[model samples]
Target: MDEYRAVALGTSFMMLSTTSFIGMGDIVTKKSLDWVLSNPKIGNSLSILGRLMDDMKSHKFKQKRGHIASAVECYMKEYSATEEETIIELRKQVNKAWKDINEEWINLTTIPMPLRLRTESCTYQ
Candidate 1:
């Protein structure tokens, strides 16, 4: 009988501990969700802008590479001196744009999540 009683008590304790942990987790998740939802606009805008910038940079790089290839082909055909200069300029522009975009991404990541949320909320309101 004593052994059975001990088993029941242990089981009860285990159940309570599990329940408490789950409840605490739920509370924390709810709080975080509420915070994010409250400032949807600023957060959403930043995310959208970041994605747009990424797409634009990718497109620009592809276009620049295509132009460089065309210029190289022209140079091969005619040995035109200006073709090499054009290729160099295209490469420089692409590299500079890539560097600037990378720097912007780094700066964006530095913003605190909470502050971003706050800004988003203020913007919407």
Candidate 2:
């Protein structure tokens, strides 16, 4: 009977450990992807700007005029600027966005699981 109890306890512990490991991995991956997808518009805007920079540098400016024009139009719609001013403004916006994301990541790490659960439970209650 004692040996049977020992085996059952061992099995329960192993199962708990496996479940916890899988749950932790899934939670981390989900959070990472959530952060990536949270600001799709910002990412798209940055990507468009990066492409514009590439086009301008490579003198493919003519080939990519549509995208360049669209980017310019977006920039103009958003802010007033010369070329240098536009670059500085864009850099500032990107840096601010990154700072916000870093703060969110820090917040996620600092919350204890029990506190998080209690807060969530209160929300539902």
Q: What is the C-alpha RMSD of each candidate to the true structure, in Å?
A: 23.1, 20.3
Off by over 4 Å in 2: 1-63, 68-72, 109-125
My TM-score estimates for the predictions, one after another, are 0.26, 0.36
Highest TM-score model number = 2
Query: What clash pairs does model 1 have?
Result: 42-120
Model 1 per-residue lDDT tens digits across residues 1-125: 23322332233322322233343333334444444445333343443333333333454465567632233343334545564464564455446645654454456543445443343333222
The Cα local distance difference test for each model comes to: 0.40, 0.40
Clashes of each: 1, 0
What would the per-residue lDDT of candidate 2 be over residues 27-105, giving only the tens digit for each residue? 4354444433354333333333344444234433543554324333345446665656655655665566556534543
Range of the 10 consecutive residues with the lowest summed lDDT in candidate 2: 116-125
**Residue 65, candidate 2: alpha-carbon lDDT:** 58
Off by over 4 Å in 1: 1-29, 37-39, 62-125
**Span of 10 residues, lowest total lDDT, candidate 1:** 8-17
